[model samples]
Structure formats: structure tokens, C-alpha cells
Target: MPLHLPHLRSVINSDGAAIFDAEQGTLTTLNATGAMLWRGIEQGHSKEQLLQSLADATQLPEEQLRLDIEEFLEQLTAQHLITSE
Candidate 1:
């Protein structure tokens, strides 16, 4: 699946990222890890590429990272912050 963000504005920093949904008038803050994932999504990375890249960067197991990514995706979907294609 591919992910898409609609009407969102974001600012990323060394510490984290802050995303604003202009349509919903809501703000979301993400930690460093989340920010990395968000950036990957913005770059149009596939789920597998994201998992592998994050695993290499963090030296974490791919299985755990996959679960984490899935959970994060679910949260974004639930919040209507992203749509999948």
C-alpha cells in the first residue's frame, strides 16, 4: 500500500516533527522515530523499504519495526491523517 497525506503542513527538526492539518485545524507532534517514518512516507517509500531502512538505522529487528510501522499507520488512518492507495 501507498500512503498519502492531505492538506497537511509539517515542520521537522532534529528533535522531532510537528504536523498541522489545516482542514481539521489539528496539530500532531511526533518523536524522532515518528518523524523519520513520516519523512520516509513523504518520500514515497514502500512499506518494505521503510522497514528495512529503519531497521538499518536503528539496528532494531525488522519484525518489531514492522509491527511498529503498522501500528503507526493504523493511528494515522484512525485520525484521518493519511489515506492508503
Candidate 2:
């Protein structure tokens, strides 16, 4: 499934990112790492690609990153920040 951001507005900076969901009238903040991952997802990167890139960038184990990414995606979904299509 591909992910889509609906009615989204955002600002990404060196420190972090702030995303506003116009549809939900809510704001969410992300750390630098989360901002990077979110950018990759917005650019249409696949889940596997995101895992590899994060693993390479952080030099962390893919297994742990996988769990973290799963959790993050779930949060995004629960917040309606992203949708699968």
C-alpha cells in the first residue's frame, strides 16, 4: 500500500518538523529523525527503503528500526496524518 498525506501542511527545519492536519485541525511535532523519515515517506519511498535508509543513517540494527518504524506508522495512522491507498 502507498501512503498519502491528506489536507496536510508542514514545516521541516534542521531541528525538527511541525505538521498541521487541516482536516483534523491538529498539529503534530516530530524530532529530526522523525522529520527525515516523514520526508522519505512523503517522497514515496517504500517501507523497506525507509528501513534501510534509517538503518544506514543511524547505524542501528534493522530489526530494532523495523519495530520503531512500525510503531511510528501506527501512530501516524491513528492520528490520521497518513492514509494507505
Candidate 3:
């Protein structure tokens, strides 16, 4: 699935990322891991690519990484930060 980001402004830093939803007037904060994932999303990475990237960055199992990414994507969807197409 491709992710669609709408009306979101973000600042990614070394420590984490801060995302602002101008349409919703809400702010969301993310940790370092989330910052990496957000960068991938902005770069138009596929789910598989994201999993591979995480696998490359961490010593975790691919299955676990998949689940984690799914959960994170779901949370982003729930918060109206992203939509899957």
C-alpha cells in the first residue's frame, strides 16, 4: 500500500520528530525510530522497503518488524496523519 500524507508539516531532528496537522490544528510527537520511519514515508517507501530498512538498522526479526510497522501505520491512520492507497 502507498501512504498519502495530507496537510501535515513536520520537523525531524536528531532526537525525534514533531509533526503538525495544520488542518486539524493538532501536533504529534515521535521518537527517533518514528523519525526514521517518517523519513521513509516521505521518501515514498513501500512497506517491504520499510521492513527491510528496519531490519538493516536493528537486530530484530523481520516478522516483529512487520508487526511494529503495521501498528505504527495503523496509529498514523487513526490520527489522520496518513491514508493507505
Candidate 4:
């Protein structure tokens, strides 16, 4: 099955970011770049979608964002903020 990200609830702050799972009582932190990508996700963005969006928003190339994008997705997925579907 494909991973999905629609079940998450997120909030942004000056210091960092938070993705919360109400059922689990868990909260995750996002670094500067991770915060950017997490905030960019809306209705439809895959891991690649986040990478491209981050590149465009930061004026960086997709290749430059690739590794970080993959890492971010990993963290999100590990925490159930996103799915692997």
C-alpha cells in the first residue's frame, strides 16, 4: 500500500515545528528545513512533491533538496506523520 500523510496535525513556530498524533500523545520536532517542507505540504504532496516544493520555495535545485527530502520523509514516516504508501 502507498503511504499517505493526511492523518497528521501540524503546527509551526519560530523555534521549530510540531506534528502531533492525538491518539499517541506524541509530538515531533522539525528542524529549519524540515519545518519548511512540512509547512509546505497541503492537499497533495508526495515525498517528491515536498522536495520540489522545498527547492522552489528556497530557490534551490531539486537535486540539492533530494537527500534532505528523503530524510525528512523518513522521519515523518517513522513517527506516523506520513505513510509509505
Candidate 5:
């Protein structure tokens, strides 16, 4: 499944995350890793690719990264930030 959103836009910054809505006047920030992973995701990487990238980039386990990526993607879906098909 592809997790994509129709109503939200995200931009990465030095701090972490910056999710803003002009109409809603909402700006949300995520943690350092969240921002990095979100930025990685924005780069159009696949789930498996994300796991590999995170594993290599962070020197973490691919299995753990995969699981966390799943949870993160689910969170994005729950927040209506992503749509899966």
C-alpha cells in the first residue's frame, strides 16, 4: 500500500519538522528523528527502501526500522496526513 495524503504538506527544517496549514493556522513540529525520517519519506522512498536507508543512515536494525516505519505511517494515516491503498 502507498501512504499518500491529499490534504497535507510537510517541510523539513534544521529543528525537526514543520507541518503547517495556511487556512488552519496550524504548525506542528516532530522530534529530530521524526523530522529526518519524514524528510526521507518525502524523498519518495519505498517502505523497504526507507528501512534500508534508516538502518544504514542511523546504524539501526532494519527490522526495528521497518516496524517503526509501519507505526509512523499508520500514525500519519490516523492523523489524516496519509491515505493508503
Candidate 6:
């Protein structure tokens, strides 16, 4: 599945990233890990690629990274920050 962010603006800094939803007027902050995942999605990475990258960066198992990424994607979808394409 492809992920899409609609009417949202994201800013990445040294610490992490900030996301603003213009349509809903909501603001969200992401830690380094979250920012990495968000940027991966924004760049049109496949799920497998994302999992591999995250696992490499965190030194975690692929299964664990998969679960975490799934949960994060769910939250973004729930908050209307992202949609499936």
C-alpha cells in the first residue's frame, strides 16, 4: 500500500520532526524514530524497505519494527494525517 499525506506540512529538525495538518488545524511532533518512518513513507518506500531500514537503524528485529510501523501507520490514519493509496 502507498501512504499519502493530504494538506499536511512536515518540518524536520535536528531533534525530530513537526507535522501540521492545515485542514484540521492540528499539530503533531515526532521523535527521531517517528520522523524517520514518516520520511520513509513520504519518500514512497515499500513496507519491506521501511522495515529493513528501521531495523538497521534501531538494531531491532524486523518483526518488532513491523509491528511498530503498523501501529504508527494506524495512528496516522486514525488522526487523518495519512491515507492509503
Listed per candidate, the RMSD to the true structure in angstroms reads 1.0, 1.1, 1.0, 2.9, 2.3, 1.1
Model 5 backbone overlap count = 0
Worst 10-residue lDDT window for candidate 6 reads 1-10
Clashing pairs in 3: none
TM-score of 1: 0.93
lDDT of 2 at 36: 85
Clashes of 3: 0
lDDT of 5: 0.71
Model 1 bad stretches (over 4 Å): none
What lDDT score belongs to each candidate, Candidate 1 first?
0.86, 0.87, 0.89, 0.69, 0.71, 0.85
Highest lDDT scorer: 3
The model with the greatest TM-score is 3
What's the TM-score of each model vs. the native?
0.93, 0.93, 0.94, 0.69, 0.76, 0.92
User: Of the pair 3 and 5, which is ahead by TM-score?
Assistant: 3
Report the C-alpha lDDT of model 5 over 2-78, residue by residue, as the tens digit: 45444457777777787764545666677877787777666666777777767877898877888898998887666
* Candidate 1 weakest lDDT stretch, 10 residues: 1-10
User: How many clashes in each structure?
Assistant: 0, 0, 0, 4, 0, 0
Clashing pairs in 1: none
Residues 1-85, candidate 1, lDDT per residue (tens digit)? Answer: 6565769888988788998999889999999988888888888899898898889889988889999999998998887778898
In model 5, where do residues sit more than 4 Å from their true spots?
Answer: 21-26
Backbone clashes, candidate 2 = 0
lDDT of 6: 0.85
Which of candidates 3 and 6 is the stronger one according to TM-score? Answer: 3
TM-score result, candidate 5: 0.76
- lDDT tens digits, residue span 1-85, model 2: 3385758988898798999988789999999999988888888888898899899999998999999998988888998888777
Per-residue lDDT tens digits for candidate 3, residues 1-73, read 6474768899999898999999999999999999889889988999999899989999799999999999999
Error of 4 at 25 (Å): 0.9
